[model samples]
Target: MVTTCDIIRMMNRISQYRQANRLLVIMPTWVGDAVMATPTLRALRNLYRTAHITALTRRSNRPLLDACPWIDDILSAWPPQIKIQRDGAQGGVFGVVRRLAAGQFDTAVLLPNGIRSALTTMLAGIPRRVGYDRNGRGFLLTDRLAPRRQLGAFVPVPTLDYYLAIVRYLGAEHIDRTMRLFTRPEDDQRAEDLLVDAGWSRQIPLVVINPGASFGDAKLWPIERFAAVSDRCVDELGAFVAIGGASKERPLLQKVIDRASRPIFDLPGHGVDMKVFKSVVRKASVVICNDTGARHMATALGTPAASVFGPTDPAWTETGVAVDRQVRVDVDCGPCQLRKCPLDHRCMTRINPQMVFDHVGELVGWNDELKHKGQDQDNSVARSVGYS
Candidate 1:
């Protein structure tokens, strides 16, 4: 004696429950892009409080979300040959897909727009696949969103906003745009030990200088320019200088340290992990770096940064905070988004050491009282974003 309308209503409720229960998110490959997607992850967690959210990202970027409360689990998206083996099989592409299917994810949100990301979800038999309609993968998605276009071409939106749009399409509400990061007590202790070992005191103002950019030489500011700024920061601002970069970038960073008139704490060759790097940035008075992951990390840690922009547009990577400043020179053939520059690199050359120092002074108050203020102050963006 049940009515057809009642049956239909029951079916709809069941469908909604299924869609909200288990979600797999494909994360962006680059470190900076992955950091920018954090707010979207936070929004998804808030919207589906009961859901189990898994992030699929490169093995190298797994540490980026180490203590992020929004993420429930982590899965490596490394090519199957490189992934860890499980379930009595040599992990190849098909083997990985088989394991993914066993997870029974009801929905997938593709933060990476590549066709392979969509294909993985489809092959796993996920009931819902949502992503931007790029790389000719629209046919694979259940909810294909068109990219924002201008002048008949897709315009580059802020990476933070681009990821947020996907979650909004999935009915997530009350989005907060603040980026957040966390550090462990061990990381803080390590940072302190490194500073003391290098004959630096935690009581003095510290300025971290990052001279290497993973993108290419076009994005790098001149090493001598970095040395000049470091020397000035030491002399004028009474700041201790620390040179930071990945292990592969040790040579480049050493060149800057060698040129500096003052001694610099060499952080690159010391085998400092990401957590330690974040802790160091969190304690710094200011960070000056090329447009790279360190720049984004400093912004998320609520540390003032003077981020230099050359081959990339600042608008696309805006920190969305008042304390962060972008130093760039708008030269004619610039913001080309190229890994290598064919012409003279005027864009970076025009941005001198003085220009960067001025921006740092403006973003981070140079007064004695402000310079000595602890990072734990109430005005810190990290506190505002629910982290310390």
Candidate 2:
């Protein structure tokens, strides 16, 4: 005679054999990682054309995917949408469990390697859970893929490859790893309105300077360096320079404008969401930013972009955009991958604005002018994050 436990195990085995008619996806928390996961989303759609897919993501990143046609629904795990008591956060986790359980998803695709993501899907009773089996949660996933590692440390592969590996396990055959993003009509109109309000026209080249980094102060290249670049672009290149930051980061934008010699269009006070932000980035002739979400955003739109790297390793975000470029000053202590610097932050301080502009100049096609003047393109930052 089979016991209750034996019956439940048998049911789970049978459920794993069923088709993934309804799917739930747990998106990465960081904005760049979420954008990187788009390929996986697309691959899943191509493989299961009729499956109703609901993606659970942070509230801040929901707007990024609002215009994506492949996803059927977006659920927020963050607060305000699903208000959680600060004192009783466990209640909120259970609340998420309840909501996910009600969806009755047949399979869950965990994009992040966090154990919490695995445990949540496991508790939701999703029959088939797929994810990288690390972080002591291998038991939570029914289909586990060991992440590429060397000597017990995870290898830094491109995020596009890391996220796509999950879908490939499901028999997806997406060879095109190019990341894509979409914006609504209103998003485009809003970008235009912002430009028009700032005395910008299509005649002038638009250079979008991203000054604020959500990853923390360690990731931030000096704001004064950004100001210098903006002034040079407007004065020398005859470009319309615009600085962007989150609402909280608006003050950083003001600081750049205050230090800049020429007028800079400020995009922080306008309450720009990710959708509107995408339209603005898409329209930019070149985007210069720290290693942050804007870098990935520009990559997705196929916009020429240059980025400054600090504590983080550049190897983690290879999007296969041939035009994309970056610069990072070499330091003994980094890429330490620390959120905040314990030392003097020599990694960011050594990188000067000109080193960055060299890459930006190349992206903007300054070949003829630079060559005419006979300026050497070689620089210190060119050695690793090359094309300086």
Candidate 3:
């Protein structure tokens, strides 16, 4: 004499079981977030070593998925063009959900924390949909976690903690919070070859510069500032500099390369492929970049990095790395989460070239230089994000 609602609830509970088999994960499409998602994927793989693991990601971020050994298969939620429709498109949500429903995925973990991510999992009819209870799509999630209240301003919370919270809601515990990346020995050799081809000596310190940002103007620092830092690194520190960016960022990247006094290699436009990108990062001594995917990649390789922040908050999504050097110009209205800054972009503009130079000094073991120079000291950026 059980009611239909009760029957449905019981069935939903029953569906959470994975049959000791296959599982699918929906990874965040942004480069930095995708790299950060590696930890969660690792935990799942470690728990279900024999289970087939598939990851769903946007086409643009496929490189990150390819670099992650934890993911066995990578599925795209939308065609390449329709991927970013999540920025504000309603139809994009239903469309992606329709695609997800066809995957026959039994369980889905949504790490992006978007309304559409949960809806897609629910539409896929994934019985066990795990995610945070924000984004107004909480009703669709079977296992929902409340967002962390605050992890403090200076002490950035590692991203693994946030992703693990969702999995813990479903009784998956005993997972360590260490952030790690997987790459083959050959990949490391290839990175070494890239450095050799650039005519750099083996012992000299290497610094990679990534001045481009896809998360709007909020996370990008000025190109001129990057060029200025590269000049200083080469002229004063004798470090080799390699400018990395996608095709769209080539023009600005070239501008930086052109202005430098020492030798610089521009590997822009020609898609460096994700595998090679990670290899290049692993070989570098340090990377100076914006709060984009490259910053996270460098960190994952256990390399020191100097990150510049702007409109985006690094608090919500920041990850762990040994080095703590970061530079961002904090304004009253910074971290506004706007695609384009409404104000004069004071947050990024105010983060002068000298500020980043100082951070770079700290990470590269040149802290004494900053002390002697007596440069201005301040932290940068908003809305927490990832680093390595």
Candidate maximizing lDDT: 1
Q: What RMSD, rounded to one decimal, does every model reach?
A: 4.3, 7.1, 7.9
The best candidate in terms of TM-score = 1
Instruction: Give Cα-based local distance difference scores for all models.
Output: 0.81, 0.80, 0.70
Give the alpha carbon lDDT tens digit for every residue of 1-388 in model 1: 8999999988755644344688888888887888898889999898888899998887778878888899789887544454445553625556657767988998888998788788777988988888899999999998788998999877878999999988776676789877777777788899989987887775677899989898888999999999999999889877888989887888998899899999898875777878788888887878999999888888777777888899998778875676667889888887899998899899999999999999776554632245455435222434353232
Please, what's the RMSD in Å of model 3? 7.9
After the best TM-score superposition of candidate 1, give how far the Cα of residue 28 lies from its true spot, in angstroms. Answer: 0.9
- Candidate 1 pairs with clashing backbones: none
Query: Candidates ranked by TM-score, best first?
Result: 1, 2, 3
In model 3, where is the ten-residue run with the lowest total lDDT? Answer: 376-385
| Ten residues in sequence with the least summed lDDT for candidate 1 | 377-386
What is the alpha-carbon RMSD of candidate 2 to the true structure? 7.1
Per-residue lDDT tens digits for candidate 2, residues 1-388, read 9999999998866654446889999999888898888888888888788999999988888988878888999998732223546654434877778788999999999998888888888878998899898889999889888999899899999998998987776777745576777778898899999897888876567899988788889999888899888888887778888878677887788988899999887776667667888888877768899998888877776566889999999889976666677788789999999989999999999999899888776776642333345543222111122222
**TM-scores for candidates 1 onward, in order:** 0.88, 0.86, 0.78
**lDDT of model number 1:** 0.81
Q: Between candidates 2 and 3, name the one with more favorable TM-score.
A: 2
Give the per-residue lDDT of model 3 (tens digit) for 211-292. 8889786677877788889888888777888889877887878888787766677754434656777777766667899888
